[model samples]
Target: MKHKVILVVLDGLNDGVARHAMGHLQAYAAAGRAALYTLTCELPALSRPLYECILTGVAPIDSGIVHNNVSRLSHQRSVFHYAREAGLSTAAAAYHWVSELYNRSPFVISRDRHTEAPDFPIQYGHFYWNDHYPDSHLFADAEHLRVKHSPDFLLVHPMNIDDAGHKHGLDSAQYRNSARSADILLADYLQGWLDAGYQVLVTADHGMNNDRSHNGLLEEERQVPLFVLGDAFSFNPDVEPRQTELCGTVCALLGVAHDKPVCRDLLRPAV
Candidate 1:
C-alpha cells in the first residue's frame, strides 16, 4: 500500500519546552501516538544548516551550509528530489528561505510573493515582510494543496515557537505561550493526518538555548524533539537518533530510493 507522508517541522522545537509548556504534545506521547526521540542536529544548530542536513542527509561540513547567509544546497540529492524521481508529488509550505531552496518547484508554498508557478493553479500563501502571519495559514494552504493534488510528500514548517524564542528568551512566558500555541496547531494537524491514515512525522530543525539564541554547540541547542506517529516507526523511546537519519527514514516509509549510505532506517525490525 502506498502511504502519504506529512513531515511537520516546528522550528526550534526543543524537548525541554515541549515537556513543560506543550500539553497537547505530552498527551500525544502518553497516548502512544507519539514516539519521542532526542534528535541531535548538525553542528552550529543553525536553521539553514540543520534544514540542509535534514533534507540531504549530509553533515553541515559536507553540505557547506554552516551559516544562514549561504543560499541553496551544495548537494542536489534531497528528499524532495528523491520523491519527485519516484513519481510522487511533493509540496512544501515553509518560510521564504525554504521556498528559495526549492525555487520554482511548483510545490513550494511560502511567504515570498515573487515565487510563482504559472502552470499550476495552486494559490501559494504569501505574507508580508516584518509582519508575520499565523502558522494556521501555512498549514491550511498545505492541506488545501494536499487534498487537491494528493501529494505523496508534504513538508510543513511552522515558525511561531522559533520566532517567540528569538524575541523573548526561552525561559520567558512569551516563549511558553508560543509553544502552547504551536502545540495546539500541531495537534490539529496530527489529528487530520491520523484520521486520513497518513504517516505523520514531527521534528525540529534545531533547538534553542536559555538565551533563546542558537547556532552554538551546546547540548540544549543541538537536542531537538522528534515525534513519529505511524505504525511504520517502531522506535525505542530511549534511543536518540541523529537528524540526518530522517531523510532515509522518510524515504523508506514512502518506498522511495535514497542515496545516503550513512543514513540507516530507524523503523526496521521494530528496534
Candidate 2:
C-alpha cells in the first residue's frame, strides 16, 4: 500500500528558526527533499485564506477566501473534501482557526477552537470530540497511530507560536519558546510516523518576523519553511528562499500537482 502523507502546519514558522536549530528537520531534509520558499498569499493572507490556498491550490481571490473571518462556502472540493470523499480517514490537529470547516467532511476526529486557556483540556489527554478543531484531534490521532490506528492524512497545527508572535511581538521570548516547542512537537510527531511506517511532511502557513509585526503583504510574513521528514522523499531544499514557491513544492512532495503552479517549484531538487 502507498504511504499516507501527513501535512503538519506550524503557523508563523520562519526559515531562520528552522535553519538555526536544524535538528530533526535538518536530518529529515538530508534524507528527503527540503525547500525554503515564499508561500505568498495574495492579499489578506491570514489563517483562513492561507488554509484556503493550501487546501485548494488557488489564492484567496480564486478560492473566495478574502479574509480570515468570511470565506464563502464551496463544494468545489479541497484536500479535506477529497481525502474524506475518497474513503480515506483524515484527522486534523488544528487549533482556534478555521478548523470548523472540516466538521461536515468525512474526517473522523473532531475538535473545537479554544483561544482561552481555562476551557482547554490537556491533563487526562481526553478531549471533548465531535467538535471541529485540529490540534487536539491530531494529537489524539497520533497517539492512536502509536497503537497502529493512524489516519490517512494527519494535520497538526499549534497556535502558541502565532499567538505569542502577535500578542507579545515576535522578538519576545514567548515566540522563541514557542518555536522551541514546535521543534519538540515536530520531533515527537515524526518519531511516531517513523515507528508506525508513515510518511510525514512538515511545513507552515507563513513566517513571522523576528523584528516584530506581520502586515501579511511583506516578504517576512509570506515565507515558510518546508520539510519532508520521511526517507522516501528527496530534493535540494536549499533554494532561493522565497514565500511564493511553497505551494508548488508541497504539491510536488505529496505527488499531487507539480506541473501547473502559478509559480515555479522552489523546493525542486538541484540537478
Candidate 3:
C-alpha cells in the first residue's frame, strides 16, 4: 500500500553541529526506529533556491530561482502538483515562501494565509509569516491539517532554526538551542504520524555557517541531515540521496507518477 507522507523541512539546520543538539532524533536512529542520511544541497545554498530544488528536482541555476529574493511562482512542477494531479490530497503548514512557490506568488496574508482549493498545487495550506514563528506552533498547525483534511501528502516547514542562525550565527548557543527545541517538538508528533501510516521525511533546506549566512560552497552551508521514518525507507540504502531527489521520493512515497529524479535506492523495493 502507498502510505501518506509528511515532509518536515527544518530550515538552516547544520548536519554537523545539529547532530549533537538533536539528541531525540539521534536516539530514534540509535533505537532503529529511523535511518539517518546526509544530503548535500546544491550550489548557492540559500533557502528559496534549495526549497525549489528539493521540491522540483531542479537546481537553482537551471530553474532561475537562484536566490531567495526571486519571489515568484515556480515554473517547474512540484510534488504538490504531482500529488494533486494524481487525485491525492495535499497540505502544508509552512513558511509563506512555500505558499508563494506552490499556491500563489506574492502571497497576500488576508487572502492566502489560510487556503483550500482542490485545484491548487497545494490544496490546503496554513502559511505563517514570521521568521520567528515558533516551531511548536508550526507542528501544531500541521497536526490540525492532518486531523481536518487527512491530506495524502503534507509539508511542515519551520524557520526558527534558520532565524536563530541568522541572528546568532550557526555556532552560537541560540542556534544549538533552536535545534534542540525543534527536536523535542518533533518528538511530540512523529510517532503518532507514523502510527497513522504517514511516511515522514525530515530534512533541511540547507545548513548555516558561522558568518550567519549561507549561499556559499562551505561544507557547513551545504550539508544537511535527512531522517527517514515509517516503513517506506530502506535501512541499508543502496545509494546516497541528494536534495534534488526529494521531489520524486515524495511522489514515490505517495504512489504517484512524476518526471523528477528520485533516490530510488532509498526506498524499499516493495514500495
Candidate 4:
C-alpha cells in the first residue's frame, strides 16, 4: 500500500535550545523511534524563503525569496505541483501566506486564518489578515481537515512558538512554555497519524537568535531540529541530513517524482 505523510513545521523550533525548552519533543526524541538531526536551512533563515526552499528544493538566491515580506512566490514547481501530478490529495493548514502562494489548487484544501477567531472552522480558507492565532485552534483545524478531507499529503505549520520567541525573546519562560505547548499538541496529532500508519516529518523552517529575532546568518538562526518517524523511517540513525533533502524525502515516501537534484532520498537503501 502507498504511504501517506504529514509534514509538520514548528516555526522557529531549534535543536539544542529547543530540547531545553520543549519537554514533550525531547521525550518524543528519547523514545528511539525518531531520528533527530540538526539540519541547516537557507541563508537569512526567514520563514517565506525557507518554506520556499523546502517546497521547491531550490536555494533562496535562485528562488528569489530572500525577503520574508514578498507576497507572491515565483512560478517555480513546488512539492504541491509534483504531488498533484502524481494524483495525490494535498492539504495545508498554515498561515494565510501559504494559501496565497498556491492560490488554492483544486487538489489542495488550504485552511488558513491569520487572525485569532472565536472558533477555527468558521475561518477555514478565508484570509484573516493578522498573523497571530491560538495554537489550539490551529491544531483543531488541522485535525478537522485531516479527518474530513483525508489528504494524502498534509502540511501543518504552527507559528505560536515563533510568535512567543519574537514577543518574549528566545530565552524567556514564555517562549519555553510556548514550545512545550506546541510539543504537546504535536504529540497528540502525531500519535493519531502513526496509528493510521502515516509517515511523519517534524521540523522547523528556522531558529531564533538569543535576541529572539531571525533572518540572519547566525548558526542559532540557521540550525533547526528535524525528526523523522513512523515505520517508513526505519533506517540507520547516524546519517546527517540537510533541509534541502526533505522535498525529495517526502516525494520518495509518497511515491512521486521530484526533478530537483539538490534533494536526495535519505531513506534510500544504504549503498
Cα lDDT for residue 125, candidate 2:
18
What is the C-alpha local distance difference test score of candidate 1? 0.71
TM-score of 1: 0.87
lDDT comparison, 2 vs 3, better candidate: 3
Residue-wise lDDT of candidate 1 within 1-271, one digit each (tens)?
Answer: 4567888888887777777777876787798767777777888788878777887788888887788888753454777777777777777677666654554332233435433342321123332223145777767767766676667787888787888888876777877788788888777767777778678888899877788699878877778888777766665665657787887778777787777643344474532
* lDDT value for model 3: 0.91
Residue range 1-271, candidate 3, lDDT tens digits = 5889999999999998667888888888898888888889998899899899998999999999999899999999999989988899999999999999988889999999999888999989999999999899899999999999999999999999999999999889999999999999998998899999999999999999999999889999999999898888886644699888999998998999899888888888988
Tens digit of per-residue lDDT, candidate 4, span 1-271 = 3689888888887676666766665666688767677898888689888888887777788888777777674567776777777777777778766665655422222333432222221123323234467888788878877787677787888888888888877777877788888887887787888888788888899988778799888887888888878777754567677777777778778888777643333464421
Candidate 3 regions exceeding 4 Å error are none
TM per candidate: 0.87, 0.71, 0.98, 0.87
lDDT of 2 by residue, 144-224 (tens): 533443556556665656766776665677777777766766666567676666566666676676556564666667666
Pairs that collide in candidate 3 are none
- Which candidate has the top score in lDDT? 3
Candidate 3 lDDT trough over 10 residues, lowest sum: 230-239
Model 4 residue-pair collision total: 0
